[model samples]
Structures are given as structure tokens and as C-alpha cells.
Target chain A: MRAAAQVFDEYGLAGSSISKIMTRAGTTQGAMYFHFKSKENLARAVINEQAADLSLPERPEGLAQLIGLTFFLAREMQSNVLFRAGVTLAVEQGQVGLRDFSPYDMWADLFRGELEAARSKGELQDDVDVAEVAQLLVAAYTGSQVMSNLLTGPDRADLPERIGRMWRYVLPGIAQPDRLAELREVAERTGPAA
Target chain B: MRAAAQVFDEYGLAGSSISKIMTRAGTTQGAMYFHFKSKENLARAVINEQAADLSLPERPEGLAQLIGLTFFLAREMQSNVLFRAGVTLAVEQGQVGLRDFSPYDMWADLFRGELEAARSKGELQDDVDVAEVAQLLVAAYTGSQVMSNLLTGPDRADLPERIGRMWRYVLPGIAQPDRLAELREVAERTGPAA
Candidate 1:
């Protein structure tokens, strides 16, 4: 999987091939297929695997943390080209061309769960329009990776901070006015979204 | 040039060699070189050529139109996979990454220009952040395209309405309370988010 991540980092999801995956993994096609059914299936497993690493506790903090956590998780995954390429390519396919739910539907499910949970906890606006907010955040963060990765290449120092700022900056507009106050309270308690 | 667009679309930026371009354009490399100095210059010219066809007015009402124009141009160039390829390659090479500045940038530039003009016209709040707002719009709209494109594939219908609703829904937040009246007045006279 790490090898797969490396290959994806170099060529991208739309650009990856089974042969390359096999060669880089130091395994044969049969060995690779034994663990995963198809290319798309393998890609999905890799994506969900990373999502697993990104999951957080049900108990939460301010709106910024909730939002920033999501963005940070995404930026962190940027280092894993496997996950990054999968989500980005999925985003490009799903948002621009058609309703691509094949792989992303699962990611969206997890994301939606987190978002709705936040809303119910008063971490989000009551009328926050969960669907639209999720859509925008996903787009912004994903687009950020695309733009920044392409323009600045993949350097992490600026990414998490920039990603955090993007969430902080945009969250105010989408969340209830009081949510900002909640963010400060939470940040003071925990250093994450600070 | 249209033939060149077709060739680049089919083969992608790096994939399409000079021989392929000449073959598709039905001209020898000699004739092609006469017009474009190098592959980069030729790619640059193709960008300019394709850009003119996708250009839109710099009006606020035209923002959504501009967004729509880019998606349409991209879709038209969809079969031409090289649409963002050369541009990304250029950016990777430390250029503006504006190689032929995808219609998206023009949309962003137009959004910035009209927004600043609106601010100048006192149609916006003096405290309003023009660049941030513009960046937000660019991120959202372009982000939507990325999401729909990479995730779902080629969804066009949902795009226009989605973007329209997006621009309309967010306009109020970016405008000052005093300018709210002008915005409503403008939106009614021109269009939502005008």
C-alpha cells in the first residue's frame, strides 16, 4: 500500500496502472489481485483506509475544529498520493462531470455523518444546509489541494496552516454567528484548531 | 488551431508529440513552426486561440455566465484531455500556470475586476475583502467543477443551477448591510448575485 501510495504520488489516480502497481509493490499481478479485486476496488480500499486514520471522537469542539479537522485530515492525506489522488479524481469526476458516487459515496457518507453530528451538537448552524456546506467544504479543500499541489508542489508546512485558515475563514459565513465564539472556547481548551 | 485543440484533447499535452499535432492539423512541422516557435509557444497560442472562443463579459451578472462558460469550454475540451494538462505542466515548470489560462481564471479575473469595480462604485462595503471574496468564489465555482468532473464525470445541467444558487446564496454575506440594498437592486435589475 505504501508503494501504491508512492506510485500514485508520482502519476496520479487517473494516471495509475495495474502493471505499475504490481511492479512497485514488489509483487506479481496475482499477488496484488489476491488482496484486491480490481483497480477501482483497490483504490477504494486505499481511500477508506486513510479515512479510517482520519476519524475522530463523537465528542467535539468548536465549529472551526470540526471543519478544520476535516480540512486537516484532507491535507494530511495529501502526503499519501494514493488517498489524495483517489479523492481528488473522484471529486473531479463526481462534481464536474456527473454524480459520481461509486467510490466517493462512501467517503461522502463518512463526511456527512461528521457534518450532521456537528450540526446536531450546535457546532454548526441549525439552518446550516448540511448538504450544501459539505459540498462547498469538500470542493474548497479538494480544490486547494489541486491548486496548491500544482502551484506550490507538495510541501506540508504551509498546507495544514493554510487549510486550517481556509476552514476558519469560510466557516464563519456558513455557521451560526455564535459558532465562532464556540470555536474560541474549544480552541482554548484544546490546541488543535487554535 | 481547432484541429490542434482536437489533437491535444485526444492525446493530452505531454502525450501529443509535434508529429501527432502536425498530422492532425494536416500541416507539416515546418508550417506549424512558422506560426509557433516551440511546443510551449504553440501550446501557448492554442490557449489564446481557445480562450477567445470561451470569453465572457466582465459584468457581475456575467459571473455565473462566466462560470458556466468555463464549464462549457471544459466540456467541449473534455474530449481534449489536454485542456488543463499544458497549463499544469507550465505551472509545474514555474510559470503562471496560466498557460492558456483556463476559462476559469478569466472567470476569476472577471469576478475580481467587477467586484473591485463594484467596491469602487460603493456597491460594496468599504470593509469588504475583495480578494478573499473573489478567491472564495473562484474556489467554490472551480471547486464545484472539480468535484463534479473528477467524481461523477460530466454533469452539466446540475452545474449551472448549482453554481447559480451558490453565487446567489453567498452574495449577501460578502456585501455590506448598506450595500445590501444595492445588491438586491442590482440582482433584481441584472440577476441574482449581481
Candidate 2:
């Protein structure tokens, strides 16, 4: 799976091949087939197992926890090849056959959980739309990492910092007026996992 | 150029070939080489000319103009083959050779222009960081479009609406407290070019 992810990450779905993946993994055809049946199946397995290994930090403030989750994901993207590969596949899935699952939808579902908690705790403003904000954040983070990686490579110095700034731009509209400043500060304090 | 852009948009840089481009363009090798020396050179030309044909609307409010430009771009991505191809090349440049010109950088520069104008006009908050905001917006929009394309292709219904919501969330932080309400209304007014 790691080898397949690397090949998919470097070359998109159309460019990737089973021969390249097998060569990278250093495994025989029979051995590979015994584990995974086809390239599409392997790609789907990679997408499904993207978040299987990591743990998320728990912050008392739900909004802060949400920010921390993204910060952590950004850090993981820099270091974890499997995570990076899943992201690359999810973004370019339109050009490939693996359209059954969307990483964006999963991320948004996770965000909605935190956002609802923040709202119940009175951290969010009355009119803040949770679903819309979740969608925007998911998209923003997705695009930011792609652009950051494209411009500066995976282990970028500014990926976490950029996400921090993204929360700064978003919190004012979502956070309660009294807690806006505090939330912005907390967002900054989520710090660079770099 | 349009043919090349279409091929690149469908298949990324690594997957695209000169033969496919020429066949799509319905041109002979002599005609093609007479204009572009190599595939890389032609790709670079497409990248540089990505925004050359776009003419952003001249709204009186600079912030509104910025929103208008993005909304315009979202709509164009659905209909304009060249634009979509350029965006694909810019995002996936890491997988290929055309790394010199970044679409994100060009977008940030354009956003900075509008942001500077808004700041000078006192429409923005005193502490608003124009460059950082520019970067965030560029990333946010890039990711949003990729997701939109993935989910519903370029002509998606909710893309412009999503972008509208993005500015609504962001403007509260960037706009002066006095103009926040007015700016939100203007943001909604920007609408989708569709």
C-alpha cells in the first residue's frame, strides 16, 4: 500500500501502473495478487486506510480541537506518504475510476462533529452555518496543501502556518463576539507541527 | 493551445503527449514545431497565458471586484477548456517539468491588487494582513474548485454559492466593522457568473 501510494502520488491515476508499483514494493506478481486483486482495489484500499493509523489530539475547546485536527493532518501530510497519497487520489479521483469514496466528505463529517460541539458550548455565533463552514474549511485546507506541496514540496516550512492563518480568517465570522479574540489566539497556538 | 489545454486537463502533464495534442489540434508536425519548439515550451506558454485572456469586472468596491474575479473564474472553469487546463498544469506542476510559473502565485498577486485597493479605500480593517489574506483566499479557492470539480465537475451548481459563502466568512475578519454588513451584502451580490 505504501509503495502504491508513493507511485500514485508522484504520477496521477492515469500515469501510474501496476508494474511500477510492484517494482517499488519489490514483491512478485503472485504475492501482490494474493493481497490485492487489482489496481483499482488497491487504490480503494489506500483511500479507505488513510486515517487508520493515526491518533487525533483532544483539546477541551471544540473549535480548538477542530483546528488542532487540521494542523495535525497538515503535519502528517508532510511526513506520511500514505496520507499524502490518499489526498492526491481523492483530489484527482475525477480523472480515475475510484469515485466510491471522497476524502473531502470524510473530513467534512469530522469537522461537523467538532463544529456542533463548539456551537453547543456557545463558542460559535448564532448565525454561523456549520455545514457551510465545514465545506469551506475542507476545501481551503485541501487546496492549500496541494499548492504548498506544488510550490515547496511535501515537507514545507509554511503548511501549518498557512492553516493557522486560514483559521484566523474564518474564526471571526464563526466564533462568538466575546470569544473571537480568544479563539484566534488559540488557533495560532495550535502551532506548527513542523 | 486549446487542444493542448484540453489534453492536459484530462490527463495531467506526465500523461499528456505531443502526438495526442497534435492529433487533437488536427495539425501536422511541421506546423506544430514551427510554433512551439518542444512539449515543455508549449506547456509553459499555456501556463503563462492562463490569465491573459481574462478581463475581471471593474466593480467600484475593490473587495467586491476580488470576489467578482473569483466568481468569474469559477464559471469560466466550467466552460473554458484552456483555463481548466492551465489550472490543472499549475496544480500538478510538481509531477511534471513546468514549475517556473505558479497559478497560485499569479492568483495571489491578483488578489493582493484588489486587497491593497480595498485597504487604501478604508473598506478593510486597520489590522488586516493583505498578503496573508491573499494567500489564504488563493488556496481556499483552489481547493474549493478542485473539490467542486471532483464532486460535480466544473459546471457544478453550488461552486459559486460556496465561494460566496467563503467571502461571507472571511469578510467579517477583513472588512472594517462599520462596513461588515454592507460588504456581506455585496459579497452575496457578486453571485455566480453562471
Candidate 3:
């Protein structure tokens, strides 16, 4: 999967060949074919795996952990060269083919659940449209990273700071200030990087 | 230029060969090459032409026009297949080769100029970070259109409504309430679709 992702990222999906991926995997064609029937199937598996890597489980106990995870994922997304390669493949796809948007649906569902928990706990504005807010935030966060990719290219120097600012602006609007203060305190106490 | 744009729109940049564009324009290679050296040059020319079409003048009078233009462009971007062609080319180029981002820079400059005018005219907040606001709005507007392009493949049924709602929400915070009310009246009078 990593080998395929690397090839797919270096050259776009259309440009990458199955033979090239097989060679990179250091495996025979039979082995590769046994795993994934076609080139597209292999590509789909790479995408599904990358999505799984980023996906987090249900967390009702800690909003801070949720925020920290998003921050970590963003950092990893910008730093990990393999992930960047996967991103290139995804961008090349550009929503051109593949009918299954189940990953997006799943992430959205998970995100909505998180926001709903916050609302139920009285940690957000009573009037806050949780779903809309969650949707907009997701859009802004993901879309901004794409922007970062375009502007910064392979050297994503400004990503961390930009994401830092995003969280600062976004968390203030959504988080209950007192609870957020405690979370910040915890993060600070944990470490400098945290 | 329009012919070239049409060619690119109907068939993607790579697909729309120079010969095809020349055929569309009813001109020979010599004439086309006299103005543009290659297909890339022609694509640059078409992009430049779009920039010229969107020139807001060194001095623009209408505050509402500035905001309206953005809203209008966002909707146009979503609905028009031709618009997607440009986005696709730009994004694709960014991933592989360095895209001719000069056109985007030109548009950003024009957008910033209008924002400065609005600020000086006391239409926008004096403390408003015009650079941030301009880029933020452009990024969100462009980014959302990209998302819609991905999700819906340019059918664009809810695009105007979505952008309109986003505009209504953000514009109020930036624009004076009286100005917003005035614009609201004008919008109602025109009875334009969202």
C-alpha cells in the first residue's frame, strides 16, 4: 500500500502504472494481483488505509483529546512525506471518479457526534448550530490545509503556525471559555510542544 | 481568447490541442502563435483575458458592487463548467508543474485594492485586516466552490444559497448594520436569486 501510495503521489493516478507500483512493493505481479484485482482497486485501498490512519474513535470523555488529535493529524499531514504523496493522488483524482464518499460521511458523522456532546454538556452557545458550525469548521480546516499545500508546496514551513491560529480563532468561538482555559492549562503543563 | 477559453472549457487543456484551439478560433497557427507562442501561452492569455474582464478599475464606486461581485463570482464559479476547467488546470498544474499563479496573484491584488477602498470609505472596519479578510474570503469562496465541484460535479443546485448564507453571516460582522440594511433593501428590490 505504501509503495502504491508513493507511486500514485509522485505521479498522478492516471500517470502511475501498476507495474511501477509492483516494482516498488518489491513483490511479484501475482502477489499484487492476489491482493488487489486492478490498479483502481489498489488505489482505492491506499486511500482507505490513509483515511483509517487519520480516523479517530468515539471520545465522550475528553474534548481536549479530540482537539489535540486534530492538531496532531494536521501536523502529521503536513510533515509526513508519504501522506503528502497520498494527498497528491487524491488531488489528482479531484473528485473525478469513485462514487463512495463514505469516508467523508463517516468523518462528518463522528465530528457531529463530538459537537453534539459538547452542546449537551452545556459547553457551547445554546444558539450554536452545532452541525453547521461543525461543517464549516471541517471545511475551513481541511480546505486551509489544501491552501497550505498549494502555497507552501513540499516545504510546509508555515503550516503549524497557521493551524495554531486557526485553532485559536475556532476554539474561542466554540469552546466554553472556562473549560477551554483548563484544557490549555493541561496542555501547557504536559509539555512545551503540547 | 474567448475561443481558446471555450476550447479549454469543452475539452480540458491537455485535450484541447493548439490545433483544436486554432480551429475553434478560425485562425491559423501563424496568427495564433504571433500572439501566443504555445498552448501554455494561449492558456495564459485566456486567463489574462478573464482577469481583464474582472477589472474593478483603480477607482471603483460601489461598495455593494465589490461584495456583490464576490458573491456573483462564487455562484458563477459553481454553476459554470468553464470555470471548473480553469480550477482544474490551476490545481493540476500546482500538483505537478508550478501553475502560472500570476493570474491568481492579479486577482488577489485587485481584490485587495477594492478591500482597501472599502476600508478608506468607512464601509469596512478601520481595524479590519484587509489582507486577511480579502484572502480569507477568496480562499473560502474558492475553496467552497472546489468542494461543491468535488461533491456535485458542477450541477450547482444549492451553490448560490450556500454562498448567500455565508455572505449574510460574515458580511454583517464586517459591514456597518446600516450599510447592510441598505444593501438588504437593494437586494430585495432587485429580487435576485440567492
Candidate 4:
């Protein structure tokens, strides 16, 4: 799986091959077939397990935690090969003739859950639709990563900063008036360390 | 070019073949090579001409015009096959082993020009970073379009609405205090017709 992730990350789904992954893994074709059955299955597994290594520090489940989660993800995209590979595959899945949107859907649901918690705690504005905001965040983050990766290279060195800027721009429109300042601060301060 | 766009849009760069494009275009391979020596060259041409069909109304060149441009793009993404194909190729260029960042850079420059005008007119907040906001807007718009296409299908039925929501969410963070409401109103009102 690790080898597959590395291969997919560098070459993308259409460019990756089972033979290349097998060579990288130092495994026989028969063993590879026994494990993954097909390259598509292996790719899907990578996508599903993209977040398996995420170790976010436990934070209260609300807006702050959500902000922390994004910061953590931005950091991960910079250094984590597996996670970055999964994101690349997901974005380029159309080229692979795969329409799997589960990764995007899962992120949207997770963000929605956080926003719902924020709403319950009066951290969100009354007019803020939790689902819409959640979806927007996911899309915005996805785009930010892509742009950062394209402009800043595969390391995505500036993704964390871009994400911080994104939160600063978005929070005032959705966070409760009195909580906006605090939320912006949280977005700024919550990073890999937090 | 139209045939090439359709083929590239549907099959992407790696999946598309010169013969296939020729078949679709009803042209000889010799003729095709006369215009484009390689698939990569053709893909780049498509990306460069992505906005060739855009005919946005002449609006004062500032934030409102920028907002109108995004709205127009949202609507175009739904119906313009050539435009959609160019975007898909640009995003999926990695699959074709192409690293052209010109398209994205062009967009950022276009957006930055409008934002700079907005700043000169005091439509933006004093603390706003024009270049950063322009880059953020481009990234946000790209992500919104990808998500809308993914969730709402290839037709991207809700793309215009998503773009509108994006503007509403982002404007509050950078627009001048008094201009916020008017800017948002412009965002809401500026659409396909305008």
C-alpha cells in the first residue's frame, strides 16, 4: 500500500501501473493480485485510508477543532506522501474513469458535523447554513491545496498559510458576530503544534 | 480545435489519441499535425483559449466586474464544452506529464488587476491584501467548480449558485465596511445577463 501510494502520488492513476507498484513493493505479481486484486482496488484502498495517519491533538468538537483540523490537514499535505497521493488520485479520478466522490463527501460530512456543533454552541451565525458552509469549506480547501501544490510545488509548502488566509476570509461571513474575532484567532494559532 | 477539445474533455490527455481526435474532427492525420505537432501542444492551446468564447458585458473594471466575470464563468462551465474541456485538461495535465502553470497564472493576474482597481477605488478594506485575495478567489472558484461538477454532475446545475454563495462568504472579509452590503448586492445581482 505504501509503495502504491508513492507510485500513484508521483505518476497519478492513469500513469501508474501494477507492475511499477509491484516493483516498488518488491513483491511478486501473484502476491500483489492476492492482496489487492486490481490496481483500481488498490487505488480505492489508498483513497479510503488517506486519513489513517492523521493524529490531531484532541480539541473540543466545534469551530475551533474544525479550524485545527484544516490546519493539520494542510500540514499533512506538505509532508505525508500517502495523504497527498490520495488527494491527487481523488482529484484526477476522472482521468482514471473513476467517479468515486466518497473522499469529498466524507470531508463535507465531517465539516458539517463540526459546524452543527458550532451552531449548537452559538458559535455560528443564525443565517449560516451548516451544510452549505461545510461544503464550501471542503471545496475551498481542495482548491487551495491544488493551487498551492501547483504554484508552490508538490511539497505544498505554503498550503498552511493559504488555509489560514482562507479561514480569515471566510469566518467573518459565517461566525457569530461576537465570536468572529476569537474564531479568527483560533484559525491563526491552531496549526501543526496545536 | 472543437473536436480536440471534446476528445480531450472526455478522455483527458493520456486517454486521448491523435487518431481519435482526427476521427472526431473528420480531418486527416496530416492536416492535424500541420496545426498541432503533439498532443501536449494541442492541450496547451485549448487551455490558452479557454476563455476565447467569453463575451461578458462591459462593466466598470473593479470588484463588481470581477464578481460578474465569475458569475459568467459559472454559467459557461455548465454549457461550454470547449471551456469545460480546457479546464479539465488543465487540472488533469499532470496525468499527461505536463507542468504548464500559465493558465492558472493568467487567471490570477486577471483577478489581481481587478482587485487592484478595487483597492484604488477604496472598495476593499484597508487591511486587505489585493494579491492574496485575488489568488484566494481563483483557488476558491476553482475548488467550487470542481465540487459542484462532482456533486451536481457534469452539467454543474448549481455552479452559479455555488459561485454566488462563495462571493457572499468571501466578500465580508475584504470589502470596505460600507461597501460590504453594496458589494454583496452586486455579487447577487451580477449574473449571466449582466
Local accuracy by lDDT, each model: 0.53, 0.79, 0.59, 0.83
Give lDDT tens digits, candidate 3, residues B72-174.
Answer: 6655565454454565556555433444655555556667777777777777755456655555555455545555555665554555544554454445446
Best by lDDT: 4
Report the C-alpha lDDT of model 1 over A35-62, residue by residue, as the tens digit: 8766566555555554544446465443
Better of 2 and 3 by DockQ: 2
Superposed Cα deviation of residue A49, candidate 4 (Å): 1.8
lDDT of 2 by residue, A1-194 (tens): 98998888777666688888999999999999999888787788778778866786543347878878888888888878788788876765544445543677888888988999998899998988888999999988988887777678666557898898898788888899998878777777776633
RMSD of every candidate to native, in Å, equals 5.7, 2.6, 4.5, 2.2
Decide which is better by DockQ, 2 or 4.
4
- For model 4, how does the per-residue alpha-carbon lDDT over A50-153 read when each residue is reduced to its tens digit? 88877754434789999988988898898898899988878877665667778998888888888888888999878888888887898889888888877778
* lDDT value for model 3: 0.59
| Candidate 1 CAPRI classification by DockQ | acceptable
Which candidate leads the pack in DockQ? 4
Per-residue lDDT over B83-186 for candidate 4, one digit per residue giving the tens place of the 0 to 100 score: 99888777877776777778888778888888888888988888888788877888888888787777777788888888888887888888887988888888
Over 4 Å off, model 1 = A11-20, A33-52, A57-65, A88-104, A121-127, A161-165, A181-194, B7-24, B28-50, B58-108, B125-127, B150-155, B181-194
TM-score of 1: 0.70
1 versus 2: better DockQ goes to: 2
Question: Which residue ranges in model 4 land beyond 4 Å of their true spot?
Answer: A56-60, A191-194, B56-60, B191-194
lDDT per residue (tens digit) for residues B1-194 in model 1: 65655665445454556777788889987798888666566556555554455445545543333344434544533444344443323222222123132444654576777677676665655655666666566666556655555444433234443454454446555566565554534434433222
Q: Higher TM-score: candidate 1 or 2? A: 2
TM-score of every candidate's chain A? 0.68, 0.88, 0.77, 0.93
Clashing pairs in 2: none
- Reported per model, the fraction of native interface contacts reproduced equals 0.19, 0.63, 0.08, 0.63
Interface RMSD of each: 6.0, 2.6, 4.0, 1.4
